[model samples]
Target: MSSLISTPIAPTSHTLLKPNRNTLLRGDSLLPKRLSCTRTRSSSTTRALLSTTKESVLKDFHERRALKIISGLQNLNKENVASVVTAADKGGATHVDIACDPDLVKLATSLTSLPVCVSSVDPAAFSAAVEAGALMVEIGNYDSFYEMGIVFSPEQILNLTKETKRILPSMTLSVTVPHTLSLPDQIKLAEQLEQEGVDIIQTEGGKGSSPSKPGVLGLIEKATPTLAAAYAISRAVKIPVMCSSGLSAVTAPMAITAGASGVGVGSAVNKLNDGVAMIAEVRSIADSLSLSTGRHIVSEKNTLRL
Candidate 1:
């Protein structure tokens, strides 16, 4: 028998968090125009890109415009992770993603009141996170694997999902589908992951993309890979799809329109040197998500080649 222990509750389709609608941003007085200028997206373009026909009911957490701030798995400095985690909670993000190190989990939970989600490729690692107060366990956040020239095959991902479920049978689990596979393959894996009882499926591909356009077009270019995956995966899986990697305030709404219930933003918030800027970026993405959620629109001219 495995060392892991828990009362395996049936998984629900929502994140462990429930963000307040525009709660911190409203208090911060973040303006759409400020976001438009800083992010290189036009408000008119936002309206156009966000306009969509509703296809399904999103999980209740999605209606709140889920934003999860990622403190990179490689980022282990308690002070740095604490800054990101604090900003996430202060800015009204639904949760904070940290390295799956149990000490990091303890450090993160101590910094913020927001629910904690721990990311690691190791299933056995999640047990410590659970003991350290991680509300959810994630088997994928593949961006770190890319710099080392490693790619996760579908079979490996499924095995990880299985092993993770075995270890933390009762913990809320989210798995990421590597964008290395074709869109069809991605959709297929997402369907299978859901069957494995994953509560959420995250999509990542920023490292695989090379944007040719300038300004806002470039921003859209960078986000295309994950957005395409979200579009396909959301349609195929009942579990929520979190569009992550290479996403920005400009493209966050597009992810929501593409069928992602929430977005996992990393560099946008974590890369900032100051907590105030980090908080502003989180609010900007949240604001963008809120404006376009529950309403999906295809732009008049296809902004994305996909």
Candidate 2:
């Protein structure tokens, strides 16, 4: 009978109700609203830094006599990939474009501090390549298909946007339109690509066409294809447009004047095996573009400078 009486336990104070080991270490030091405000300020600071860096880099790249060599290295082997990227870097390339292969991406990332771009026919492969460390991605290098009997029609190009968006919604997408299309079609495709959320729309010279070659330069000759696509796409979309494939230092200014935000050249750098020679070529192109850009800037500043 004496042992049957039950004693009631006193309620512990809230302060004494200690949190679990996990909970104890997981509390935020600031209130939710304050935390959010602090995060916003930090984000703004970071963004400002990044923007300033990008502007300075672009300015220097434009102001100096250097062409951003977009060297195309299709080899899947890691060692070959490293060698090509290393050569491009020593040659003064702004960025390197590699085929969609995971090993190549790792090699590129490890070998150089330059921006890495991944090109792929498969959206999933592009995603993997980006995850592997690619800062950019190019959808077309039409030269690969020239002999494969595979053509990158307007429809096919548009479908690529749909697929890429579905797979990698936030990726910085760059879609290239085959130069084979007529000017009208090229413009139309450029407009469509812009509307589809592509970050950059590149135009090529199409079918054995070198934009600067003696007579084969249909669009490349009159500065029609790349210029047309850039003008159309730049006007249609807020994203940047790059004129690539057949561009050179001599014609780079025209490409920029026609509305290209940047130009991408492959053969001008890739065909050369010497890094120093490559850098010199890029530097010459960069110099030409900078001088031209400087003239435009001076004209605009003349009114203000006075």
Clashing pairs in 2: 65-286, 65-287, 66-286, 67-282
lDDT tens digits by residue: candidate 2, 205-239: 63345445564354347455566666666666565
- Which pairs of residues collide in model 1? 51-296, 51-297, 52-296, 52-297
Top model number, TM-score: 1
How does residue 172 of candidate 2 score in lDDT? 64
Window of ten residues with lowest summed lDDT in model 2: 1-10
The candidate that wins on lDDT is: 1
Q: Write the per-residue lDDT of candidate 1 for residues 216-286, one digit (tens) a residue.
A: 99999999999999999999988788999999989988988899888898987888899899988887876
- True-vs-predicted CA distance for residue 76, candidate 1, Å: 0.9
* C-alpha-based local distance difference test score of model 2: 0.64
- Candidate 2 Cα misplacement greater than 4 A, ranges: 1-68, 77-84, 206-224, 291-306
